[model samples]
Target: MTSKPPLLASMFAPWPRIPIDTTDGSDFFHLDRVAGSAATGWALGPEGAYEQNLTLAEVVDGAVREALLHLLELGLIDIDSDRLNAAPGLPTHRERAVP
Candidate 1:
């Protein structure tokens, strides 16, 4: 049997050469509807939830991280559904929250 590839693990890939910035986290977790209504806004899809953009993670504020945890516990973000896909790369301001 073959092991499943590391999906989220890709973000932590080796990049020592890439400088890492050290700073405090932020508190910002903007949410939007997934393929909801065409005109009006509403949750849709497998169950019901919005798909967040990777760019939003840039503001990794302590409070935001807390909210994220809350959402995760509430099943807003599927830790198993494999949703919220994004390109492999650092987004603007993301490094600022690093370290």
Candidate 2:
């Protein structure tokens, strides 16, 4: 009488498929398909084979963040913390009503 592993635990079990390479020589884990599969629950690989969308979201998110940080390090993008933190004042209607 062995207890079954949790569904989430099983869902995250090691990925069984190997990544295919693109014609341009990039490794194809199909990031776009995988990301979309979070809502669809299925992804099509480069070979047109269906795959279960699992921990790939975390992988894709980390990859995107790494790419953005790399771009920032290269000075290709700017981050204005002050602008991001600045709060917009009250709505025009509220401000007029207050006065």
Candidate 3:
């Protein structure tokens, strides 16, 4: 048997999901698709349902980081996912593991 190359991993990547989070762990949130429309939204609930809707412009202007964080918190993305472990954001392979 032989190991496959890492570049092949990106060939079947899934589309990114929204990122968001509750400042505290007391809240639970979920994304919901809008019925009868092409748009999607999110909501929070269990005790009470509260939603913070995002505008298209807001999302395009770095607001997506919130959704990314939310997805990370939920373990929706793998620990070694390229988006989370890309270079420049991390130390070089030759660098010491600790400073």
Which numbered prediction scores highest in TM-score against the true structure?
2
List the candidate 2 regions with Cα displacement exceeding 4 Å. 1-54, 87-99
- Looking at model 3, residue 54 earns an lDDT score of 42
Number of the top candidate by lDDT? Answer: 2
Candidates in order have lDDT scores of 0.35, 0.40, 0.36
TM-score of each: 0.26, 0.32, 0.26
Give the per-residue lDDT digits (tens) of candidate 2, residues 1-99.
123222222323432232234433332334433434432332344322234333766555544555555556656456856644542321222112211
Q: Which order, best to worst by lDDT?
A: 2, 3, 1
lDDT of 3 by residue, 1-99 (tens): 123223323534433333334233423323311110112232232211133354556433333444455566657543556745542343223323322
* Model 1: residues with Cα > 4 Å off, grouped in runs: 1-60, 79-86, 94-99
Q: Which scores better on TM-score, 2 or 3?
A: 2
- Model 1 Cα lDDT, one tens digit per residue, 1-99: 123334344665632333323222411212222111211221222222333322333323333544555566656654544323552543333334333
